[model samples]
Target: MKFLMSILLVGLSAVSCAQNRVSQTEFKKLMKDPSAQIVDVRTSKEVAEGKIAGSTNIDYFSASFIATAQKKLDKNKPVLVYCAAGGRSASAAKDLKKAGFKKVYDLEGGYDAWKE
Candidate 1:
């Protein structure tokens, strides 16, 4: 049925995105490479609460996410994005890929997980 097919498509999309996420250890190793740009996609308020060091804040929910990301980074370079938890970062990673970023990564558990 069409409904079943739609569900299947959505499931597949989520799976593909999940496959793109990386663990905190992997993220830390990537940071050591220095070729990666780490991004925090949480809101200003969220950042005020606390954030991972070396991350640049560019709220994913903002109308200017695309513009801010463009200004803060080179579209061709590798970028790592994270939010308070994993949701927003995952969303941002998808957008970055659509925006022509060749290598984009999202923190699996986010800052909350990192802080622990």
Candidate 2:
């Protein structure tokens, strides 16, 4: 039972460690880099409100989310993703990882946080 518990903890840790989460400050720093691909995973309506400069909109709810991302994003380069409040970006980061993206950075508090 102890061994099983240990394995479970390790598995959970691995999953959490798979993606990097950054604060608004860290995300802003990353955005300054031209190589980093900034992706806004908010809905089109939300994006129309306002978004981080240089971020490309990719609706998380889109039917071709993954396919569109693959075509628009660089798999080898760093990717910075954010949503309205953070939840969607975290999920998007996981999908980005499974798609073979080397480095995935999720905005800690999403675009709302970025504004603050």
Each model's TM-score? Answer: 0.84, 0.87
lDDT of 2 by residue, 19-116 (tens): 48888878888888889999999999999999998899999999899999999999999999999999999899989889999989999988888787
Please write out the lDDT profile of model 1 over residues 23-91, one tens digit for every residue: 999989888867789999988998999988888989899999988898989887789989888998988
| TM-score leader | 2
Highest lDDT model number:
2
Superpose all Cα atoms of candidate 2 onto the true structure and report the RMSD in Å to 1 decimal: 2.4
TM-score of 1: 0.84
Error of 2 at 104 (Å): 0.5
**Per-residue error (Å), model 1, residue 107:** 0.2
Regions more than 4 Å wrong, model 2: 1-19
